[model samples]
Target chain A: MRAFVRALPWIGPALVLIALVVLFPIGVMIGNSTRDISQSGVDRGGVGLANYAEVFAFPYFWPIVGRTLVWVVVVVVLTVVISLALAQLLDKAFPGRRLVRMAVVVPWAASVVMTTLVVHYGLEPYFGIINAFLVDTGIISRPEGFGWTRNPGTAFAWAIVVAVFVSLPFTTYTILAGLQTVPGETLEAARIDGAGPLRAYFGVVLPQLRSALAVAVLINVINVFNSLPILRVMTGSIPGYDADTVMTMIFKYMQNQHRIDLASALSVVAFGLVVAIVGVYLRVVRPLEEA
Target chain B: MRHTRRASGIIAITLATTTGLTACGFGGGTDEGDGGEGTTLDLLVPSYSDATQANWEGVIAGFEEANPEITVNLEVESWDNLESVIATKIQGGQAPDIYNGGPFAGFAADELLYPVEDVTSDATYADFQESFLSNAEVDGVAYGLPFIASARALFVNDALLAQAGAEVPTTWDGLLESAKKVSALGGGIAGYGMPLGSEEAQAEAAVWLWGGGGSFGDADAITIDTPENLAGAEFIQKMVTEGATQADAGSTDRSPLMDIFIQGQIGMQVGLPPTVGQIEENNPELEYSIHPIPTQDGSPFTLGVADHLMAFENDGDKQEAITAFFDYFYTSDVYVPWVQAEGFLPTTKSGAEVLGDEESLAPFLAVLPDAQFYPSTNPSWSTADSAFKALFGQLATGKTAADVLTEIQSQVDAG
Candidate 1:
């Protein structure tokens, strides 16, 4: 009891900081969600779940939510898988390995908005290098013209491409660290035991790097879910299939339309989704702690 | 180490609290100067390049010289996403005293703008051109001062037109025929180009509809589904399909269109007067002439856009100073140079008369009588724009004009 009392002072300061910075703002958001936001400052009213109901009732709400989920899953999965492959390939000592590493990190270092603008203007119909090359090669009979990001399917595809590109460097570095930690002696032993490269990778290296993989997956999941800039700059906040991640939708409601209450509600919903995903992740990975 | 950490934490907390308190203090304090002997006015204007800056500074210097008691601080903000930034500042009660209140004033009027009814006088308001004044008036009160106005005109590559043996089109059918001739000459340019992307597309599309005697709304209700509007939409669709414009017409913005026109890739484009200056700067050899937007029924109609200067609700002395500054702004010394720098039509009758005498500026001034203001005052115009853009995008791809118009009308009505 005395020891507990002695530790309370240090813990109290940390708790206060967390409560003020995080919990208080969340409480305020919840309180705001219950009020009506007319021209006047937040109307004090007792409306239980009405804002949530309005959000659900809107025709665009469900489709946007569904699209956000698909966006996060696709971006997270592709980024992790491709980055893992690249990290493994680059983990070995090879010619120009340092240059390849630098090349991989360059996109991450550059501003995402600048990158999107380059892509947008570079792919523009009249002056874009893509069209110029296509014309030169005679692959296209006529100019495919513009509108690459105009269609929903192509827009969504481009969004995933951008997300993956921006995410690759960090994910690759994380997985590369994991690859280094997998004991070389164990791999040599597996090779002497008649296991091929792919077999050794699956049986020996994979299990060893599970913790690093967990961290990479979790980081990518949170990042892809919260990412706003790539989608925003690329598609201009169109609320479905490309620019309608949960974070972007919440921001659009708050800033573009000035619907702070609905934005708060959407934010709370997004927060809940993120928390649930993290919770499941922790639970699933709990058994691997001993490793 | 423990003591150091504790001290660092204290410093962080103190810094945060100080910042928060200072922000709160600024918000709560009166933005308008007290009726003291000396007052400072914070004026927000859109950012400009060095030449435009020098011109504005010259005006500011003259204003300051005239009113030594009042000091003006110029804050130049970028135009992109500026509306939302202004809204946030106003909502937070830290907006500048005199800010750029352009086309977004309608949005501001809906609980955003501080009412300026008391600050402005009839005599002061009378100094502006009637069309400019009327455009700034919202709900029967002048909440803004009309500063600059721009109009869209058809820019023709005279060499290309003469080479193709075509005259400048005055009507819709004539334009189509000219377009066909220009396309056949193989200059890698379209005969016409309009920004079909989002809000701009909807706005440009509306000009054609209105020129053809169609209406989107009639003060109280949606009216865009009429046959005339459909015919206008169909004409745009035909232009895209027939290669009179590029298939990518839905995505081309003003910049790309201007680039192609400047490069002599396109024979004709609908652009503003500023484009003429740009063409002159980029390619002085390109022979181009400006004319009014072609009408469907052989009448002239052009799209005119205006910027407004507004006075927020403030102290009496600040109001007087604002009024004086605006009076100084309208004088030929300040107004003429500004018009030339911005490449916009002058807001004063005298200034417009002066610009009309210049041969290069005459075409833009000539079309002023036919210019129509944007037909919307809705706060949700941005939303409407995107919806309209989507419909037009579908139409440009291949949807029937009638179906798109019906769908758009329904959507606007529902919203």
Candidate 2:
């Protein structure tokens, strides 16, 4: 008790900040999920679990949930795999390596909304620059038919590509840092033992990268799952939640439906689902980490 | 001990500055609330064009010059962000004194607005078009002041029609035939620009559904699944399936499609009066003619849309200042120029008389009398509007008219 009391002041400000910034909003969100909030956001008293019931009963709820899972998995998996290769390349000594490294940060340094907007207009069916280029190069027959972000199927695919694009720099940098810490002697040892370069990388360096990979994967999963601006700008005008994740769907509830209570309810469910997903991922990753 | 004393001094200074800043914030709030010689009002409006902010600022300049005691703070938001911005402000207890937006029945239902009479003089209120004023009524009491009115008309590319050897269409069958011919010309040109996307699908739905003698019912009910409405939806699906519309019509929004039309890539589209200005600015050489929107039975039809300016029930002190602002804004000298600049029809009698002579405004003006409106006075109208925006695009994705309408009907019913 005395030790904890002595430590209190050092941690007190951080505790207050978490309470104010994080815990308070969560408490309010859970409270709002139960309340009968008006479209204009007037709190009309509590309705118990009725708002949650309505959210469950929403017609597109399950489909959107399924799409969200696919969205997170595809984007995060692609990001990690591509990032691993890029990190290895970036770690090697090369001429103008620093310049190339700076160039890689462009997508990350630029605003996500601005990046998505550029892609959105670039894929316009008529007169888009990218569409024109494809037509000119004989890659596409014409510039009028390829509305890449308009159809749900193609829109979802393009959104995944963009999600991976913006996710690369931070992820690559993380793994690259992990690569720097791997001892050169170890790779030399594996090479002397008659292991091929590929075999040495997979068997030796990869295991040392386990913690960094874990951190990268976990953060990417959450960030990709909760990503809004890419999908919002890409498929926002496309009607229906056919391509929506829970984050965008929750925005629809508030922006389109004007039902704050329902949005709050769905938010709670989304929060729970994210926690469960991350928990399961951690449980699986922990055993691997231990090994 | 000396280092500890220095830390305590820094903390003392920080606490003092924080308290000082908090007091200044409170002081500013009270000054805004005080009903003395000088008063400030908040005005929130959506950007109609690049000129929207300038026009409002001009009005404020004139109003303030005339009435030196009242000051107005203006916030201009894009049409895309206006609703959510207003909602956020209201929820945060910082609703603007006056907000210009589309649907106010939701706000009116919540008793968040002052009645029209409370915010405008009797003469100012009497000057408004009776039809528009009635459109703003909720429970037989007006809540919104109609700020701008627009009626939709069919804009046909004269060059495209001539090239295709098709005359301008008057009926639905004639339109389909004309569109097919235009599409047949085939150098990346669309016969018709069908925008069933979320941006303004409700407007396009209004054009077809109303032309087919259907209504979106009223506050208490949704009539979207009616056979008349179904016929309209089927016609849209027919247009999509027959390759008459641009590809991926489901996700094409009005603005980008309008850009295509301006570029002379689209043959026909339903357009507003402002579309003429856009065409003039972007591609003045493109020959186009405006006509009455084609109907199933060949009767005259047009979709009328209006955005309203409403006063939130702010503190009691703002009522007089708001009325003064409204009266100043509606005066013919001030209102007509702004209307002309924005290229929208005026909601006041005198402003219309002044703008009536302009050639481009004549076609839209002639059809204003027969224009059908979305049931915006209905509290459920926003819900129904959003439903159309989100679901009508499904028709392009091979969802049947009946299925889409049934889904929309259920959404409205649930609301």
Candidate 3:
């Protein structure tokens, strides 16, 4: 109390500024979500829950939500699982392990958009290196590259691949941080108790990794849910909303479509949806961390 | 003590965020007359290609030389994402002094742009191609000077057409038939190229809609579901079915058509005159001709596209600098070379006539008088463009045209 009271003068000004900076935009977004966005994009007047109702009624609304959930689930789970395997391998003493660790972190250092562009070229039908390799090995019949982002299925597949690829390094590093804290004696005890490496890892190190895995998976969920640039650059929303997640769809609505009210309403709901899910996720996973 | 520490941590984070955000606020404040030098006009332009950006920078240099006191800060953004970029800037109250874009009706309605009459002279109006000038205006007031005007034309690969023994189709039915024949040659040749990628897909589809006597609706209302529009939509679907366009056109970008056209694999595509530069760069000897997009009854109309130079009011010398820069930039010495470099038809009547007989410019220039813009000057048009692309993409990807049109009409009418 003394510390807080003594700091009031400096903190008051900062607190006020922080409120203005952070809360102000959120307040405006909430306000606009309920306003009728006129044809000219001005707020005509209040429309109650009209905008929310409209977003809910959008034909692709639920489908986009379903896809977003699927995308978030897959990206988060795969990132954790892949990173866990890599982190386990990276944790052990190996020749040139420092070089391998540096290589593992390289993707995290590179720009997401630049890497996405490289991924785009790799999947392009006409001149994709991936297509050339596949054809050269007689993996597929056609000489012309297979149209990767042309359909929703392939686009979604490639989007997940790129998402997992970019997500790998950060997740691996996080889990690696957790790995360092695990006492070597605990793992040795498990091994001495007549457990193999897989059994010891599964029952001991994996459970102990709860906090780091939770942090990684939670962040990835939020990131993949809101990620727009990768799918936007890769797919160009070719099939429009069909290839976009809810966040990207919201971007299309606000930016390209200029449907401000609809975008705002969608944003508010999306924010709430994510918050609620995270809350539930944390509640369910809290026990493991506590253990 | 733990609770106090947690509260302190929260305050620390909030304070840091506040400081960071407040710092970002510094550079965007209104300049109260940078009373040091003359003035600096922030000119934002949509760069069509690398050459276009170079031409813009060159024009800015000439303007700076002519008006030594005033400095023009030239910023170029790609056309693909410029609209959204500008929208965000405007909403954030950080709009530039001058912007190059389409006649956005929303901007006009919101009065985001100053009326072009602020800088345009009678001679300026007389010199500019009337069609380009008129379309850039809303409610009797124009926003910007049209610096780049591109009228879409049916660019035919003469070699491929000759090899396939097909004449240039001047009518809608004939186009389908000829495209089918050329596609039959089939060494990865597409008879027609349909772009279903990005916001530009909606623009390209408008050409076909125009040829079928359909409108995206008048200034007052949206009638995108007109029978004529359905006819146009059906025709596009038919081309896909007949193997005249790519199987995965809905997923393909404009690069494929441009690439194949350069390689003599694409027979026909509705393209701008600037494709001459692309062709020359790729394969200079590839024979091609630019003609008007064919109509149902062999009538003539082409989609007239443009990039307008608009000003946003920032008060005082900034406004003055924008007007002054426009006047200097449009002069023949600066304008002509910019036009020659960009390869688009010169937006001005004087510039057009001066280059009227250039062998490459003649065909596109000949059709300047009859070009039509999409009824999309309205700000909501872009939003409608998304719906158009989605529904149109579905149609191209094998959805029913009538069903797609119904959805488009629903989205627009509701808008």
TM agreement with the true structure for every prediction = 0.85, 0.94, 0.90
**How accurate locally is residue B324 in candidate 3, as Cα lDDT from 0 to 100?**
77
Docking class of 1: incorrect
Q: Please give, for residues A153-263, the per-residue lDDT of candidate 2 as tens digits.
A: 888898998999999999999999999999999999999999998999999999999868876887787778778889998898887778888888887887788777787
Q: B18-55, model 1: which lDDT tens digit per residue?
A: 22211221123345553577777777777644466567
Docking class of 3: acceptable
- Report per-candidate DockQ: 0.17, 0.33, 0.41
Tens-place lDDT per residue, model 3, A20-67, is 766665666778788886533444789999999989988889898998
Cα deviation at B88, candidate 1, in Å, is 0.7
lDDT of model 2, residue A80: 94
Candidate 3: C-alpha lDDT: 0.75
Best by DockQ: 3
- Residues B303-400, candidate 3, lDDT per residue (tens digit)? 87787778887553466676677777777777877888778878886777677778877778777677877665665565577677655677777788
* lDDT, candidate 1, at A7: 95
TM-score for chain B considered on its own, for each of the candidates: 0.83, 0.91, 0.88
